[model samples]
Target: MVEIKIALVGQPNVGKSHLINSISGATLHVGNFSGVTVEKKEVEFERDGYRLKLIDLPGTYSLHPYTPEERVTKEFLLNGEYDLILNVVDSNQLQKNLTFSWQIADLNKPMVIAFNMYDEYSKRGGEIDTEKFFKLTNIRAQNVSAKENFGLEELFKKVIKTYQEQNKPRIYYSEIIEEEIENVREKIKDCRFDKRFVAIRLLEDDEDIYKIVHEKPWFVELLPQLNESKQIIKNEYDEDDLKEIFFEERLALSKGIISQVAKIAKRETLSEKIDKILIHPVLGLPIFLFVMWLLFQATFNLGAAPMDYIASVFDSISNFVGKFLPDGILKDAIINGVIPAIGAVVMFLPNILILFLGINLMEQTGYMARAAYVMDGILKRFGLQGRAFIPLVSGFGCSVPAYMAARTLKNPKDRLITMLIIGFMSCGARLPIYVLLVSAFFAPEVQGNVMFAIYIGGALVGLIVAKILRIVLFKGEPEPFVMELPKYRFPKIKALLFDLWIKTKTYLKKAGVFIALASLAVWFLSSFPRENIVKEYSLKIAHVKSEVKKEELKEEMRKKILENSYIARIGKIMEPITKPLDLSWREDVALLSGLAAKETVVSTMAVLYGGNSSNSKKLIEIIRNSLPFTAAVAMIIVVMFYSPCVAAMSTFYAEVPQWVWRIFYTIYPNVFAYFAALLAVSLIKLFS
Candidate 1:
């Protein structure tokens, strides 16, 4: 079989990933490309004796590279290795997506255009003349619903024909551009590049293109001539500005082709008149809120049973080990310390998996784009675009995944803005805190609304933080909100699950390693009081213990041993500092140390308080009842305002260059926590 290299290249979020996923019979990550941290993916498969290796490039609307993702795409297309280029264009906004198709043709490559999102056109009572699209661009156009995996037979057939059969070159630039290109060609003595591609890029004032011409041997020889011609073009109008002139010209061409050959009936739109109500600001926002609330209810509350089941499984294993193992320090460590930590994370798995499943479903159905569009007006003031909501809403499921989701954006500043704010959104890790606090503090009548308040509080905090950061640290205006609202379809459950499993399995692996080590360390500190009791007759125990019963002596020895342990010593040292936060030395040590990972707070409390504080509420109760009311409440507020783990900090450090800035980021949260607690206590005093 002749191996054919077919590249799927287009602007981001045009459903390129889904098109690849559909053709490969594999669920390639079809979410935001930046979110997935994917620069490119090459997959090999065969269809009808034609072996194909499909390369998925990062989405770019224009080849004038602004960000790393767009730059990477331009470089890949210039490589000229692919036998045929499959241009994935979103059909609803063909005007924009097709512009890149014209640019691709400028490269003089054999290409077949895969009209993605064709269903959007069909549903909206719009007609597209594929022949007209082909004729105008000098490339073949085929329809496809990438989300539904339709038109693969025609797509692959075109791919096979384009690769194996003789194909004509598709280079149709304006006569003016062609004339400039021919004049520029004369100056070159010998050049290895496809002259047309180089000439076009050079005329467009691509700095990278200029650098290449200046660096290469032949271009170096003919540099002055190319520059002179470029200067002339620059004086009249830049070549990068050529697309607009061409765009208007093509629209007129398209209108002629469309008017004659295509007709769209005004019969009821396939999607119905529901959009009239659905898109209305007053009704739409409420409807959207209801749908979002339902999704959360389904993913969280409905999935609680499975989450509880997973918890029980891990919990029982710990209990079984406690029963089966010899009654010793090691046994206790295995059961209460390591196992409980692992169980705490595993319990959330069902909820986490289900959450992403719904997100994946939203993404596949194309409602996500619509949601972004609707959110745009509100989000603009908050330093967010419609796209920003995708990661933020998804953060409710889990922040780590949500952080990864921010990568879908191609703008660097926007990506950073999204990242900084997303952490403030209430993550699932913080859900247990809400459930515990809301249940304890609020009446049952107000619990649901109280829970909603805390969630909205996080979102508001996150967006404000993003907005502030954008103005002070990150330097850039938010790009205009421009994205296609793709046609909706029923999601494939199997595909959704496959994607969700990839995400959940990664979290499980993290829980097993990081949580395991943290838990073991907590066990060591907690078990020190027990470990120090090795000597009986070796010490002066012969005096008092000689008169005491064996069991009583052993008990007394254990009590005395705990008082001298290193953890106790450390607690004493940290006592003063923790006092303001309403922490005893023991709680302080746990709080100070557990800043490495929030999950450690519970494990440390389990050992320190000598109570099985498996849940956040139980732990909070132990802390509250241990100290005075004000001090006990301080711990909760502190944790709420504290910085994320060291790992998360390192990620921030790498992302944001200023270490002092990161320090500011860290110190501010802890300070906020302290004062927020103080404020809460003072407020309670006034209310009472």
Candidate 2:
């Protein structure tokens, strides 16, 4: 079987991911591009005696790279191994998207254009003549809706056919640009890229292309011609900026070609109509808040419906296994430590899933863009732009990705400030901690509202801190925000379920592996260095005649062992720091364990508190009866404001090179968290 390597390229929000998901039988592998945080997605599958491998490059608006993601795309297209380019374009944004399409077509590779979102376009009476498009650019084009599963098969057929014929794009620019391109193309020698590509990029003064061709032997001759050609084009076009000249040339070409090959849609777009109310200055913010509140309410109330069953299942398994195993360390670890700790974390999977599902829906249906636009006004006041909302919103999912998402913001000051406060947005990993505390402390009817408030409070506090950082540290005006608002559509259930399944698999994997190991270690640390204490107590319980008194003595032995345990000793060292926050040794250990991963906070608490009759009670029940309400509030406050896990911190470190900023990022969150927790405890004491 022959393999056809295809590069999938498109601008952001052009349904590129949806196109990949719609491919039948395609297998996907996702990772970061080498030495960069930009995500790389590749799909492979057999189709009609050929194995097609597709590399989904990060979305780039143009070959003139402005962001790291765009640079990644440009670098891969220029140098990565690929047999053909599959450029995906939004059918509705023809003038803009096609301008980029023309720029990529200059690469002179075997290429195909996929006019994605044709369903939406056609509904408004728009049409594209694919045959005419081919005649105009010598590149086959298809009008496909990845959302509706339209033309995907035909699109792939064209891809394979283009590869078999080794057909490259024959796109041409204006007469002046073409003449200069030929002039520069003549001097090019021993170049890996197509001569025309090298010439055109040179005319545009692309630094990346310059770096590549400068070392060539022909560069000495090409430089003078390149400079002269650029001057000629600028003078002819009456534009000083060579880059702008080329951009306008491409834009003019796009407008000309689109007019000849496509019929414009006549209807006012539904997205524009919806935006009137959704992005309205007065109502947009409140509507966004209401939508978010409802999502959290669902995350808490709907997700809690299955918790009892999950808790019971784990209990039954523990009891059944405990009956057979001998009274030994392995049995104790499995029953009292690993099983219960994992159960405590696993039971919150529904809450995490609901939260993720809500986020995915918002993104898929395109409300997230509107939310960003609505928030831009507020973000600007804090020295951030609408683009910063993406990473900040992603922080609700996880900080590692949120930190990576910060790469989208071009300004360094905006990126750093957004990253610094992502921890305060409270990631999904911290959900279990919040849920555990809220369920234990708040009333049943108000649990969802409390959950919503926790999220809102964290976000509000994060905004305030961003303002402070901007005023004191960054001290600059934010860049103006411009973003494409994709049309709203019904989310495909299959895609939503697939995304949920991925989230579910990831959460379960962490529960079964990382959380289990952390629990075992926590159990071991808090269980041992007490053999003498245990042996001493065992003697007393053994001598007792009354069954009730024997159980009491056993409970006493458990407490004594826990108090002398290694983890407790470790917690004791932090007593002075946490004491003012109304935190005890167990809470101290839980928070400490949380530095590794937030899920471990609950697991550590489960291990610390699961002593007597734990097998018969839920972790939440035990926690509710054990800790005071004020301590729960303080723990929640601390978790909300503290430094993120090691993975997120390392990501921040990697993204940011300066040690001074890294040190500030590392130390400020914990300092903020401590004072926040202290204040919370003090306020509660005064109120009570």
Candidate 3:
């Protein structure tokens, strides 16, 4: 089959990845771009007897690179191999998106423009004449909505046609800039880049381009002419920075072309009406809190039914495995260690999925951007950039990506501050622990409210800590907030399901390896050093004549064996440290094990408890009856404020290189959690 390689590029939040996902039969592979940490995604699919490979470059605002991601896009466009450029433009924000488009058009490659999110734009009475756009810029254009999967087939067809014709863009700048470009282009001799492109970059004083061409044989000849051309442009534009002058030139050209092709209906958009209340300074914060509370409530309450069903399913599997295998070490490990540990973790899948669904919906409907806007003022007061809200909110889902999301904050101090406090947001892995403890301790009616309080409480504490950090460690004026609020539209069910499927697959995949191994290790630690206690207990039970006496002897023997186990011994060693929180040895072990991954806490508890009982009661029931109210409260608080999993810490370390900050990030949160839990236990005990 014929293969067409297309470079997919767009600004941030322009639905570039969404468009790749919308295509039928596309297989996606994700990795880092060569020599950089920025994520690179490539999609492959077959359409109309042709195999297409789409390289989804990092979303960048301009070819003048600002962030690492933007540099990746710029480098790939200039040097990387690709057949054609598929520029995805946000239809509603044409002027800004088109400015970037003009920069890419300077590459002089086969190109097609996709006006994405046209569905939302059209709903708000915005119209784009694609034909007029093509006539003005001499590039094929398609009005498409990647969300609704409309016009994608036509868009791809145009892409193929453009490639077959070997068509390139004919974008022109103002007369004065063009005159300087021509003069520099004439002097440029043996450079790999298009002369026009080199001339423009030279005019803008691009250091990267200058470095490249400076090594060329023709540099000695070109330097004098390049300086003269730049001087001429600077004089004509009456500006010191040629880059700014060139930027304004592109902006003006974008505006002029937008006027010719775009017809604004000039009506009040639904997003605007909703934002008045949702983003109101007085009401927005409360509304955001209410929405978050509702999300947790639904995650716990709605997920309960399926959670029970999953638990029962695992119970059946364990029973079946028990009957199928003979009573031995392998059987014991599978039934007690592997089955229960994995089952405990897997049972919470419904809760994770439900929470992700809510987050995905907020993102799809454009509420997430408004959420950032709403929180910017509050976050700014705490010395975090408004953009930090994205990563902070994302921390509620997971921290690995949350750390990456911190890249949006351009200021280093702000990004580091945001990364440090993200651990307090309480990720989904910790939700199962909360659900277990809350269900065991609190009444059924208030369970959801209690869960909501835990999340909100943690977030509030995170903000306060951010404020403290700003004052003590990295004090500065917060970066100004500049964000785009996209128009709201109904989320497509297909897109939501696809995203959820990926999340579910990722969770299960992790469980199969990481959770399974951790569970087996816990089982070994708890079950080992098997002495002759079983034989001794059998002898005593045999000697006892009465049935009640024999059963009581058996129960006492089981407790003794567990108390003598290695896990219990280790827990005892750590008991003095956790004693202030009123946590028992077993609870101590579980919490310690949680440092690896939060879900392991539940798994650890399951193995520790389920090994001693053949009762039909669920793990939650057993835990509820086992722990006191104060211990449960203390455990919840500790988990809320403690250090995140090893993976999240590694990600943070990778993002921030300073050894001192890494050491601080490692030591501080755990210390904070310990004292917080100690205080919580003391207050509860005093009140009671």
Best by TM-score: 2
Question: What's the lDDT for all of these models?
Answer: 0.65, 0.83, 0.82
- What residue pairs clash in candidate 3, if any at all? none
As for lDDT, the candidate ahead, 1 or 3, is 3
Error of 3 at 536 (Å): 4.5
**Candidate 2: count of backbone clashes, pairs at least 3 residues apart or interchain:** 0
- Residues 480-516 of candidate 1 have per-residue lDDT tens digits of 6567655456676655766666666555564446545
Candidate with top lDDT is 2
Clashes of 1: 6
Predictions ranked by TM-score, top down? 2, 3, 1
Expressed as tens digits, the lDDT of each residue in 1-688 for candidate 3 is: 8899999999988888789889988898866687654668899998778889999998889988876678889989999999899999988888899999999999889999999989878988899999988888889999998888899999988888898899899999989789889988888887778899988888898898888888888788888888888888888878999889988999999989988989875554577888889989799989987887787677667877797888788889999989999977788788888887687567657766776788788878888777777777777788877668767876887775577567656656788899999999999889989988888889999999999999999999999999999999975554556666777767778778877786666555643455556556766776676668777887888888999898778767756665677777898998988888888888887886786678778877776675333342487788888888888998999999988876566567766768899999999998999999988888888888
Residue-wise lDDT of candidate 2 within 1-688, one digit each (tens)? 9999999999998989889889988888866799765558899998889999999998888898867788889999999999999999999889999899988998999999999999888988999999999998999999999989999999989999999999989888878889999999999999889989988988888999999999998899988998899889888988889889888888898989988999999765677888889988899989987886687677666766787789899999999999999987789889988787677557657666776787778878999778778877778876777768767876786675567557656656778889999999988789988888898888999999999998999999999999899889866554546676778878888888877776566445533454456556766786888779978987898898999999778767776776788877889998877888778889998887787678778877876786433442488889989998888999999999998876567567767868899899989999998888888889889998
**Which 10 residues in a row give candidate 1 its minimum summed lDDT?**
26-35
Candidate 2: which pairs clash? none
Task: For each candidate, give its TM-score against the true structure.
Answer: 0.77, 0.82, 0.79
